[model samples]
Structure formats: C-alpha cells, structure tokens
Target: MSNLPEARASRNLHKTYEGGSSIVGVLQQYAHDAAPELLRESGVSFGLQNTLDGDPFTEATTPENRRASLLSLAPHTDEIQRFIPLYRHTIHPFVPLLVDIDEFELHVCEYLESRAAGDLRDGSKTLNQWLTGKGINTIAVILATLSCSSYFSDISITERSTTALKFVARAFQALQLANYMLRPSVEAVQTLLLLGNTLQNTGQSDGSWILLGTTIRLAQALGLHAANTKTRGANSRKKEALWSVIVWQDCFLSVCHGRPSGISKAQLKRLNFAAVTGPSLSYFEIMCRVGCLCVDLTEDVPTLKGSVDLVEAIDRCYSNALPHLQSLDKCRNLHQRLEFFALQINMSFTIAVVCRPAMKKLPPGSGEDHYHQFLTTRAKQSLFTTLRTFLAFQALSSMPLRNWSMLHSALTSMLLLSVWEETRHDPQSRDLQERLVGLLLAVSEESSSADTDSDGHPSYYTQWLSPRSIRTLIALQSAIRNTPPLTDHVSPTRSVETLLTTSEGASLHQTGLPVLDSQVPDQITALLGSSVAYDYDQFDWSTVDLSPFAFIDETVNMPFYDSSQSNGFI
Candidate 1:
C-alpha cells in the first residue's frame, strides 16, 4: 500500500523546519495570530487551542474532529512556525494528544497512497529538509513523535477505545529519517537508547540487547569514556566504566529473556580487559548476571557456557585487579569488584559441582587432566576465599539487600565443597569441611533468630531450606557417613542424626532420606539400591504418624497411618 498522502505532504513541513530559519519563532507568531479561528473551526476549546499553539499534534484531543484537524495541520510548516513557541510552552499539556499521533500518521500514509504523486513525494522531501535544518531539540521532538507511533504499533491495550496503531509506524519512520540525517550527534545515541528501552519494555530483550550493544560501541567511539578517564585515574578505569554499562545492559536483557545461560557471551567478548577500570566493572557486571542466571534454575545447564566463561573471565579480572585493590586509593571500586568476583567465583564452584559428574574425564597424565584438576582446585579455593571475605564484610557493615541471596548461595556452595572433599582425599579437605559446617550453622542461626514463629520454629530458616539445599545437605551427610571409619570419629548414623537435628535441618525425614518406616518411591528406592538398608522395626512407628511421609503403600492403595494423635499425624 502507498504511504499516507497527508503524511507525505507533511514531509514538506519538516523540510521547512529543516531550512535553518527561526522555525520556533515563526511558529509562535503564527499560533498567536491564527490559533483562535483555527480552534473554533476545529471545534476545540479556545483555551486548549491557545495552550496547544505551536506544539506538535498528539493523541488527546477530545472530539474526533479536533484531533484530526490538529494532526492535519501538524504537517504544515507555515502553520507550525506560527505556533511553535506556544506549542513548546504547552508541550507537557499536549502529551496526551501525542498518544494518537500514530493514528494520524496512518491516515496520512493511506491518504498519500491515493493522492497525486507530486503532493505525496514532494511533501515528504520538504519535511525532511525542514527538519534537517532545525536544532537538536526539534530533532528530538520529531523523533519522540515517531517513537510514540512505533510504541502503539508494537503494543495493544484492550482497556482503551482508540485507533492509534496506524500513526505509530509512520512516527517511527519519520524518526528514523531524522536519525539518519543527524548522524554522530549525541541525539543519535539518545535515539538508540530510546529504541532499546522501547524494545525492552515490549519484552523484546534480544532486540534490546542488540541495540544497546550498538549504542555502547558508538559511545566508546565518540570518546564518552575519555571524559571520565581523569577521574578514573587510569586508561583501564575508563574502559571499565564503558564495559560496566554494557555488561549491565546485557545482564538486564539476559534476566528478561528467562535467564538464558549463554545470553551474555557476545557482550562479554566485547569487554576490553586490558583497561584497568574495565576489568573491575566488567567482572562486577558478569558476576551479577551469573548470580541471577543461577537462581533461574529453569535455564538449561548445557546452555550455561556463557555463564561459566563469565566466571572464568572474572577470575582473570581478579588476578589483574587485586594489586590495585590493595591500595586504599582504589579500594572502593576494588572492593565492589572483589565482591562481585567472589560472587561469580562461588557460582563457578556450584556450576562445577553440578557439571563435573557429567563432564567427560581426561586420560591419565594428559594435559586435559591437568587442566581439569587446575579448574577444580581453583574453583574450590576461590569459593572458600570469596565466602570468607563476603562473611567478614557482612559482619563489618550493613550489607546491600542483594547480598542476602549470597548467604543462601554460600550454603549451597558449602554442600558442593563437601562433595568435592569426598571425591578427593585431600587432607586439607577436612579443614574446609569444618569451616563449611561452621558457616552453615552461623547462617542457620542468623536466619532462625530473625524469624522465630509462635511455635518457636525458625520459619525463615525452614523456608530458606529449599529442596535443592535439602538434597545437597543430605548428600553431604551421606558422604560423611560413607567415609571409612577413623580412629576417633563417631559412628556415621549418630553423626548423620546430629546434622539432621541441627539448626540447618528441616523436613530431613520427609525429604526421602534414610529415615525409618518411611515408604519410598520406586525411583528413590532404585537410587538407594542395596547400598543403604532400612530397619522398619528400629523406629517406634506407634508414637509417630507416618502417613504424610509415605510415598507408596504396598499393602493397600493408600498410605497407612500410625494411628497417633500427639504427633499431628496426617
């Protein structure tokens, strides 16, 4: 279909504005002289017309005729110049009117499609030229109009009665034309950011990320980083500032895209690690992204290489940024950098533990074996140091709200650490296990104290113990149980019971663990196999209700109750 004739005609108006004359001044004069009569003819309130004088047409005119009249006049450069001043002053009041500009654009596009070729084509060229001659502010207004149109086309509101979608496309096209005409100006960056924000708001995260990526590159090319280089005190600092924003944008996009694991790979690759400032900021952003992605367990682990690589990159950043971090002058940014580095390190530890079992093993003495060993050891050490630092920092001051998630994450890491220790017979593993147990106890105590219930149960602590955490804790205890008998260590059964009763314990018996008389599903029973044994008679089943604990009952199609009243038997 041919574009709107009125819209094409309006293009001539844009050309007039682009002629470099005092368009705003001219528009204001025109509005003062002709607005009253125009208002009467358009069937709008004189006051509203006066208020809207010189302003661009928007969506809010009350009567259909008034709105159409305003839009029809919007493309006329001569009429626009006369009221430009009044329009500028009353722009805020006309914001609602702008909403339906998309409808007007559509009307024009449709009209141009049927109109005389000269009027259609000549009008667009004229508006283009006029707009080109105008100042950045004029350009912004034009672009904003176009953006409003695009927004309407992309979104739908069932609650409202209006036809604004058509104009939306035209508005965007107009804005695009303006953007091309004014290349390299800060306006271009603003336009890109606006488009990115629009795409983000509409749930087009990939599109947003792509636009943001382009903006970041352009911002860099234009030397936005150079302005802050002096305050950053190093070339590296400037790069860090630049990459930080890019990483943050990517992180937000990744989070919006259902926490896709490898979404940030392209963004991460663009980071300039050579710059001092860039490393810290880049690492900080990467850590935050990884942490967010980890919590979104819906994401496939196999698609998480981007997150894994991000962690590895953070380690490299830590190595490079640590020396600068030691100096008090750079300590502020350094601390933040380390904090996030530590976070990513912990994430890496968790990912390694989850992925290692499935990972392909290397041949004995092969370079791959050495590489794997190095990663495993580094991940473990990083997890420990990061947790210690994080805890110490928390103890010293009021930590940020987001850091609370880290505590839960640390507990999970401890579980992984125990698993690692069991797999490898390192003597220091015992010390690490002790530290992890202490940390878990402290965390549980803190949680319990903060939210004790009427029944004296630690609700917060219980709630925080998610199924994943429960499984990890059980695995850790089971690992301890499987350890060979030592000279002075207590029995595995006693130790396991003690751990289950500790502050970290909740629903231990209900979580398909090796509890007495608890019916287990075939899958779980298969998992248990002949490795674990259950003594049904060891527990006084008469004293407790085991109905809710039953997974499957063999004798009957339903669960058997112990017929106890005191234990709140289900």
Candidate 2:
C-alpha cells in the first residue's frame, strides 16, 4: 500500500492563522470552519480513500498501513491533548513514567499537522511502525485517554464526556490494530493492565477480572515478574516499575473483591525491588504490603478465634503499616495528597479486615467476650473515623470530581457510612456525607454532555451515550445489567432503596465475603463460609434496614493504634 500524502493546509487558511494565534485560538477558528460534530465524532474517514495502495492487511504489511493507522486517529489529537493533563493529574501520580507527556504531545502534534512548513513523518515515525502502532507507545496513549473517562462510576459529566466516548472508540480500534493476542510485547503487558483498569473502573468488574487473569499469565510468560534487567531488549528499570504497578493493582483489587491475589509472594520476590526511593513510591509499596495482609485476614482463616498467635500476627501487620503513614507527611504536592487519601481509606478497610475475625465468635457472658468486643469496637471505630477524615478532605480537595475511581470508592464508602450514620445519628458523619453528595451532584450537572453529529447536532445514540450517564456512560449499558449510578436527582430515601433493593436483575448466589452485606444491623457473617454473628456490635449486615442512625463515637485509630509500639510507624 502506498502511503497517502498528508493533507496540505489551504494557503489562504494558513496565511490568516499561521503564527497569528495560539493553538486554542486556531482550534476555535477551525471549529467554526470545520465539518459538523457527527463527522468529527464518527471521525475523519480512513477507509478506501486511505487504504494501503494494495490491501496491506492481506498483502505484506507496509509503512503505508502504519501511516493509515496514524492518520486514521489524527482527528483525535485535540481530545488527546485536552484529556492528557487531566489523566496525568488524576491517574498518573503513582506511575508518573507510564507515558512521556511532552514527547507524546510533540509526536502527536506533528502527525496532526499537515502544513507545507512541517514534516508529518518526522516525529510520527518514532512510533513502532513495526507493530503498526499497536505497540506499547501507542496503546499507552490510548489507555491514558480512555482512563480519563470513568468506565464505571458516575462522575459529573461535560462536553468532555463526548470526548471520552470518542477516545474509547479509538482505544477499541487501537487494540485491534495491536494484534494483541498474536504478539504480546512487553509494553503490551502494561497496555493490558491499563485496559483491565479501564474495564474495572467503568463497572465491568466481571470482564476486568477475566482480563486481569489473562494479563497475569501473559506477564509471567514474558518473565515480567523476574528481576532480569539486561534481557528482552527492554529497560529493566521500566520493566520493574511496570511489574510493581501490575502487582500492586493485582493485590489491592483482589483484596477489595475478596479474590485471591494472582501474583503470589513468590512471584513478587522475583521482580527485584530496584532501589526505588521517594515518598510516593514508598507509600505504594506499603499499600502492596497491606494488600498481602488483607489476603491473610480474609482468605486464610485457619486459626481458631482469639488464638494468641493469630492476634499477635494481625497486630504486627497493622502496627507495621502505621509508620508508613508518616511517609505522607513528607509529601508536599496535591497529587501526593490525593494518593494519601486513597491510602488512608484503604487503611480503614484493612483495619476492618484485620479485626473482623475478633467479632466472628465471642465468648458470651465471659471476660473473654469483653476483650474481643473491645478490640472489635476499636477496629470499627477506626474504620469510621478514617473514612470520615478522608471524606472531609475529599470534599474540600476537588480531587474526587476529576477522579472516577476515587469518587467511586469514596461514594461506596459514603453509601455505607450514610447507613451507619443513620443508625448512629452521627452529626459529623451526616455533615461529611451531605457535603460530598452535593458536590458530586453539582459536578454531574455541570459536566452533562450532549454531543452533536458532524452537522453539529445531537442525535439519539449520542444523547444516549451521555444524556444521563454522561454522569453515567455505564448507562450506555443496559439498566438491567448495570448497578445504576447514584444520581443527584434521586432523593435520599429512593436512593437508599435503589441500592439496598434486592437484585432481581442480579443474584446474591455469588461467592466470598460480606461484599454486599446482608441487611443485619451491627453484626458480621462469613459469606464464602458460614460463621455466627458476634456478640460485639451484634448486628448482621445482611439484615440492615434504612432507619435513623444512633449517635456513636467516631473515634480515630488512636485507641486501636499505639504509636510507641507501632514501631514509630504512626
């Protein structure tokens, strides 16, 4: 296939805009003169007119086919530019090196420009034409862009919502071009990890779980889990960094979902922890360690309740995590602060997991009961307080409105906390939830999107993709299939009812943990296996009904954590 020549800008158009304005100004001018929104959304045609001179897919592959792929996606350069910053801020704090922001922008800019003054092939050729842009470099850009749009949670919607959908469309196309199954490159593993995150974030947990499993296997086959730095013609440091992220996500999500971690300790040890030092990286490593503890607490229930050995081990792990929190004090940036928010929430979650067993079976009417009950109470209080602190920060921070996963997780905690507050009548908890809820609703309303066609008009499908789920692109899915977004319009009474209502659409006949607790008030149950409700806080989650909450002490982790013994962790 012969490569098509770049489109030449009209001499008159260039004469008027060239060096006369900033990119934004030129873009606005072009917008008024450009094709309609539908054509833009459908994207510039790269079909027969741009096909390889000779059916490159059927005949031998050629540079022309790669050129075709690059040109086909050229129209999206604006969106890529628009969302890249948001993605970097919202999602890149932990893995800052995933994509080279300036380099990618420069490369993409050249590809998009067809002016007589510049060469389109100059920076664009740096992309691996060998893989036809299905390689890591290209896929990373697509993943970063797609992730900028939440897959699952309903964040506030906006014109960016349409841009998000467009990126998703491009991502699907990019994956197809990558020949994902046929040739799994090292960068492909990161691409797969990112895509899994997208699916998981967008509320496709079932699919994401399956995709992650495939990713784990592929990563292992490629020896990505190993510490080898000189092999595979890849940057060992980069590979190690990728491995760290993959494992961290694997462990953390696995614990959250009550599934086993796919990359075991043995697998992790093989990935040499290169001398990585920094507040953010250290904090992430701490999270990975806590994820390991969560697995032990939830999945490995071999010891008898109140076993001295079991209690000590749990205490040791919890205490070990306290010092890691000190690392946050060293962080002096917004991204680090937001990352701290995630860690803080996860700490409460881990605390609850650690102490849950103490609640499983208490010796009623015995001194032992009081001891276990005290520990359990302290743990529960820790969970509530940590959640409240994070939520308070989240309300003032403006981070959640931009981060889908953060918002999603925060809301899930809010939903649970709201119920807790209702029963306990905690004014503090109520205040926190109320502030967050209002902010969430406001953002949703502000970002509401209604994309138009190339004629610069809206159509039904475009509206459907957005309409409601612009706050909920997941709404693009079947209402019956999705857990409906917690919308701003839905009143509190109805909202609770919607969430707590039995899923005639889904089923309770699933596996492991009190993920969706039974409606029982203040009690614990073993879901994957059967266990009795504890005497302490003897309410079953399964039996909880919406009602006025009683006021309770939302104590911080102080009572459960002793800084002196926490090995200076706190």
Using all chains and alpha carbons, the TM-scores for the candidates as numbered come to: 0.36, 0.57
**Residue-by-residue lDDT tens digits, candidate 1, 1-570:** 222133234332221111113343344456766674342333223221122312243433333433233234233333222323232222211122222234434533433332333332333443332333122223343444344333323122210001122232333344443333323333344445445543433323356666666666555444443333235455445444434444444444443333443333444443443455533433343443443333333244332244345446545544444433323344466344444444443444445433432233344565355445555555556556545544554453323111222443454344444434323334454444455444544554454455545875433224323232233344434433343333334443333234334422333333323332222222122222222432233322222233211211221112112123233211
lDDT of each: 0.37, 0.44
Could you tell me which 10 consecutive residues in candidate 2 have the lowest summed lDDT?
548-557
For 32-87, candidate 2 gives per-residue lDDT tens digits of: 65664433222124121122222333445455675566456433545444555555
Which runs of model 1 end up more than 4 angstroms from their true locations? 1-259, 262-316, 322-367, 398-405, 421-427, 446-450, 453-457, 460-462, 465-570
* Superposition error at 53 for model 1 (Å): 24
lDDT of 1 at 311: 46
- Supply every candidate's count of residue pairs whose N, Cα or C atoms clash at under 3 angstroms: 56, 45
In lDDT terms, how accurate is model 2? 0.44
Q: Which stretches of candidate 2 lie over 4 Å from their true place?
A: 1-67, 74-76, 94-143, 146-158, 229-234, 271-281, 296-336, 358-378, 402-404, 415-570
The candidate that achieves the highest lDDT relative to the unseen native structure:
2
Q: Give the least accurate 10-residue stretch of model 1, judged by summed lDDT.
A: 548-557
Question: Candidate 1's C-alpha lDDT?
Answer: 0.37
Identify the leading candidate in terms of TM-score.
2
